[model samples]
Target chain A: MNLFKIVTKNMRQRALATTLTGISVALAVALTVAIVHIKRGMQQRFEQSTLGYEMVIGAKGSPLQLVLNTVFNLDISPGNIPWTLVEKLQADRRVKAAVPFSVGDNYRGFRIIGTTGAFGETFGYKLAEGRWFTCSIEALRDAFKEALEHSQERIAKEKGDAPAKPAAHHHNAAEAVIGATVAQETGLRVGQKFIAAHGVEVSPNAEEHTDNPWTITGILAPTGTAVDRGLYINLDSFYHIEGHEVRDAPKDNDPDPGQVSAIALKLRSPIHAFPIYREINDGEEAMAAFPAVEVRKLFAIVGNIDRILLAQAILIGLVAGVAIAVSIYNSMSERRREIAILRALGARRGTIFAIVVLEAVAICAAGAVAGVAGGHLIVMVANAALRHVSGFTVAPLTMEVAELWVVAGSVALGALAGIGPAWRAYRTEVAENLAPTS
Target chain B: MNDAVLSLREVRKSYREADGNRLDVIQVGQFELAAGDQIALVGSSGSGKSTLLNLIAGILLPDAGVVCVNGTDITQLPEAKRDRFRAGNIGYVFQSFNLLQGFTALENVRLGQMFGNGTGDAVELLKKVDLAHRLHHKPRALSVGEQQRVAIARALVNAPALVLADEPTGSLDAANGTAVLELLRQVCTEGRHTLLMVTHDPAVMRHFERVVRLEELR
Candidate 1:
């Protein structure tokens, strides 16, 4: 019989053990594949979530927190700097574009960012269904009307939204431009008006801007990550909705005056980020945060988790290797007579050795087949689920160069497993084995 | 002296006991067989008769001696060369029939042929064995007499210059054993190939042209 037929027949005879070994290899392979997919997914998300500004300028706080508040719409502001200081930074020769953002308002948990046209361009944000506002008055009407539409649509959709429109408008009254997730989640439509609800209950008077309604004018495109949760507006619209101008109106009509939360600065080069950030934050009241640096730090914080999972994969792979070894070791006992027969039939020791070792290779190949199949199945299921839930598609477990190394490594392990018993068979004495004791 | 197909010169072999003393299996001895010769080695238990056959087949190395098969000094050749030489010129039939379990009788015979024999026409060899009908039958399905016949066909398929049969009919009944032994003698006679058979049955030895009896190992 051919070597492949012999090995497969043997495995079929011991059906249960072979299946158990195959499944063991499969489980190990599945775990490795899943962990690798997650790591890659997180890396891409982390990078996308930090795109836009070359440098973020704020009050003296953690650079990471400054980036989180301004770029990611998470945590608190880096504390505010005076409006005049932002004006000076905006005037700098290296600054190509600048947009100020004042955070702290939330419409059903999506952060409201009061910004300018430069902010939309800075984040590469484009209207999936509507247009961007250019003038200050247009920005104000856009923010106010959009917020109302967002809240109203969320309630009407009965999925995610604000309660009935609030009564008063304050610092939180600025309009809301729905993120792609918010629009899809709440089924919001353009022109709907809604309130910007506050989430920080610790500050009961913190976001009392219900009187200023924001109308939903546009929805942003999905960027595959957290940006799908962002809300946009303009700085002057926020102050107008907050009644800051209404209460202290001058005798004559004039432009609304107030300080923005912070200004996002874009530099000429990514390499210029650190130097410009250091210069901006050095001895000044305002601090500058680099998105790239903060993302790198975040990656460093969670780097060991991936390594731990990888270590577990290696451990399971080793265990599967041992199971393969035991299979060969046990088979040697059953095949002793057959081996002796072959020897008597003129098979040299080397031929016997080759056949036994080939059996081991055949078994490992079975394990590899099982592992790759099981691993692919898990990746496919994960991809389908992620696509449905987050609208972000996960790439299937690719047969990378590294995986080839793993297969070669397992084959080497299989060889080691068979060497002991196959060598014993090779050295057997044909005369003694075939001698008639009776 | 006339082109001895198989020869042994001063062959010796021994086994070591747990107590460090030696139990000699076979002392130094010499023997030779010519083409068309039918010889039987008859002995009691543990008489080293099988060891001599193994030496001739190049399956075992004598402690000290020379073995030549088909005029080539097999004992002096390296292990690989010796195996090649054996596969090229020597064929063996064991008492157990020694057919691979998973393969059919014909496949077993073909396997033997592949290792340097059976390079010629296969249909001719099947016709000679008279096993043409039973070619597809596995060893387990075949009766003891039938299995022995298959083994004989395998040994002769390569058309080796010499054939070694160890108790080829040991497991058969009277009629079957006689039929198998007669088949072996008739095939070797027709092909002019040398036959060296080791057996315990005196009745079977009568068919041999020469009979060598060993009282003890030497």
Candidate 2:
């Protein structure tokens, strides 16, 4: 028989211990695989969600925070820049298209984006159902008129005056084009009215719209990323939903409508982004953030987290290796007579060593298979839970370099674990051993 | 005998005690074994009979000696070559049966032929030991006499140039002991294999063609 078959047969001889060792290795493999896959999955999602964005121009704060708020839609904006300032930026020769986003409201944890219909086209968003907002002043008036006809008409009256001109849109009211995720989450369809409020922390019992209700006119399709969880509306409508009202007593009573959470600037070319970024940051009041750079920094942060976890996995993997070593050592004691018999029959010490090493590798391979399968199982369960609870799909297993690294490392660990025992077996004295055996 | 199967010269062996002093176990000046020869090594306790058997089988390295088996000086061979030489030419029978406890009698016999030049048909070998009906029995399941027979079959299955028996019947009663010795003598003589049996029993010594009485090397 070849060395492998003999080692395997002997492993099966102690059915319980061999199986237990295999399971131990499998558990370690599974845990390491899961951690590695999760880190890669999170990083990949970050990359996918951040693609296509060149740069973000916002009021000066943390440049990273500006990127997070604008590209990922994960955090609040870093205050707001004036519309005139954005207009000035659009006028710049290098600037391609400048879209202003006003964010304040959330349906639940999802963001409500207020921008032009051009935002959809620029971002390449396709509608799962319904159409993008027509960006017409008449459409906004009709939506406000419909909200006035709803059950909470008392609050609708408090919406104050409507937009005056063909260009002007809202004074204290707006319309909402429901995102696919938000619509699916709340079962809100076209013509259904819901009070849109500012911030992700609003209470469930709070008046959804204290003054005006926003009608759901459109729903966007899943982008396979974060956009699925967002809501969109017109910039003027966003101000209206936030209860911004211009009064006749113009002194300090008039709230400034020019204030926005952040401004997102799209340059004509990638090469123009750094120049514009420098230009924006050169002004003391605002900071120009490179969404790509900030996103990489974010990955770096998470990378450190992954590194710590990987170190812990290595530690546990070593412990499992030691357990295999101890098990093999103990078996040596029980099988010394067997070794003596082998020696008497003319088997070399090196052959015995190879047999022992082969046995260890076999156990490791079994464990690695079990661990990888188990790790994916964990990912599947976690993905299902995220989908059910958060309606946000998480990838359980994705083909990536990190996963390959884990598999290769696990096999190497198995080989390393067998080294010590194999060495001991090679050095054993045949004469002394055979002299004591029957 | 046409040629001696085993030859030894001026072999010296010692063991280190707990107090760091070396105890001389054996100081044999010379020994030789011819084909079909059954030589019994007889000695009281601590007389180095088992030690001498190990020296002849190439299992132990003497402090000073030349051990030639099948015309090759095995004493000068490296660890791996010496082991190969031993496996091809030596078989060992122990006092305690020394069968791998986990394997059935058939598997135990199969193990004997594992590194040998040719396979030993375990069924036929077991039948030779009158254990064909009990081939499936584990060492733990076999009685002392049956276990010894399985071990004997295992030792001779490889058809080695020399068979080393260390108190092969030491753990058996007189009835079982005599039966085991007769089988060893019969197999060695019939197969033309050199046999070296270590024993304290005078009756067991009678089956050997020659007898070597060991004494403490002082």
Candidate 3:
């Protein structure tokens, strides 16, 4: 009786064509939704992981490589800069804080970093169990001083022989702080001991540092960042490990005494970041690079891949639109008698036109809704797998403004596809179609 | 002249053959039907009886003529307005029954009422046509006579002043055809609607008070 009921009945009569067209639209929409979700999620994760650090100073090399090694714990570091440079940066008035990192080791494929406790605080890491390591040389020196004072007092009180001299340096190579992912994957609990290999990847020939096995003194809580996949130990302990120190270096060629992979710097004011970056790159000691700038460059390279995927999604959408057009137009031939009946019943040409177009819109709207839901389901599954493999999480069921535009665009395409069929319906001749069949 | 419910003046309609020859389908100098008139238009195949009915219903436009229904000249109006006028004042019943295939008998009648001046109840009209028991039955489920009855109910649901039936009994067997013709004549008489029907069957001519032969009119 009504236009909607009539349209529904007509579609039901040709269920196969309707379903096929709907599925085509759904496929296009799903691809578009998945692409937009992944691209945005990647950008958000990269930007969030780089927060709180203004610049990274490392050995002269690729800035992107330096950032990837220092921030994301991927790829090898360029080389080690002098530990003295970290101290100098810390002493500078323009630098609010400087955290040193020493890399090139892994525990079962998870990177092991030698850093100070300040590094944990700089990256906002919270301990899940036990306490931070006695990792810094200064902390060890203070502990040694306290132990010496206790022995002297005991000697005086007992009227015993003179107290023995305290050792100048004591390396706590036995202690380690493991990240959440490292603890989960390795099944290493507090007080458990493990040996770290000398390289970033696990290979049969990679040498293990068995001379100084490490105990898990603390475990970090999950932060949804690269930190969740790292193992932290004392800088001094890293140096004391066998085969860690370079034996022979020309004094003139390598002026710095100790080595560190990179220094994470926090500026006194954000405005001072570029000035200090220029000063370090211009200096002979090390090179300075901004993490944000390097991440942008990385995305520019990744953008090419994104463009190809987006084009493929758009092509699928266009093909789906054409499928809708062909399906509707084909059905119009069979519907001529029905259209003429409506015309005889006093339906204007515009009414017939509107009915056809509305049918197309209805089909597309249903497909769009299903596609969006399906896209998020895929994202949820992918997020679970990515979190397990890489310790990175992308939230599922997140909708962006661009996705809304995609839905709108699909509806417009459906309407556009309906135009040809609707025009044919509008031009139906009542007299010819209603001629009596002999 | 004012009492005539349907009138035509100098009506002419033609068609072009495939070989570029012109053919005149219907040509009538003048025609008139009084209020409540029940007339039959008789002709053989290709004699343009159906074409004349279509022109009178405003479903087709004449090449040069005026078709006036219910005291208004439909030929002077634009296509859109003509459709509205036909919907409000003229109803049609085709030989094939032309009942929308998927719609129930009640829905088909209701559809006719939707475009009209909205004056009559569809259920009441179906009951008048003795199809109350088959209100929810679709055209395919009904017998041929029952389907024609539903079509009659649909054509009268708008209470139009003029009803055009193009070979209304042409598709039925002898028994069903006679029954449908009798029912149609009784319904139109009771409603005081002017009836114009086209048919080639001589048996169907007896129910009408006046019979117009297309051969003589041309």
Restricted to chain B, the TM-score per model reads 0.94, 0.93, 0.96
State the local distance difference test value for candidate 2. Answer: 0.73
Per DockQ, what order, best first?
Answer: 3, 2, 1
Error of 2 at A19 (Å): 7.2
Best of the two (2, 3) by TM-score: 3
Which pairs of residues clash in candidate 2, taking residues 3 or more apart in a chain or in different chains? A60-A286, A79-A261, A80-A260, A345-B87, A346-B87, A438-B94
* Fnat, 2 decimals, each candidate: 0.33, 0.73, 0.55
Ranking by TM-score: 3, 2, 1
Q: Specify the CAPRI tier of model 3.
A: medium
Would you estimate the TM-scores of all the predictions? 0.77, 0.80, 0.86
DockQ of each: 0.42, 0.49, 0.60
Query: Residue B21 in model 1: shift from native, Å?
Result: 4.3
Please write out the lDDT profile of model 1 over residues B65-132, one tens digit for every residue: 87888788888998777777787788788888877767778777777766654575555666677877
Q: Give me the runs in candidate 1 sitting further than 4 Å from their true place.
A: A1-16, A48-53, A57-62, A65-89, A100-115, A123-264, A283-286, A380-393, A435-438, B17-21, B102-146, B182-192, B206-210, B215-218
Best by lDDT: 3
Tens-place lDDT per residue, model 3, B1-218, is 47689988889999999999989998998789888999898888989888898888888999998888888999989988887888888889999999888889998888888767567889988998888899999888999999999989888888889999989898899999999899888888998998999888888988777998887665
Between the candidate structures 1 and 3, which one is better when assessed by DockQ?
3
> Clashing pairs in model 3?
none
lDDT of 2 at A412: 79
Comparing 1 with 2 on DockQ, the higher-scoring candidate is 2
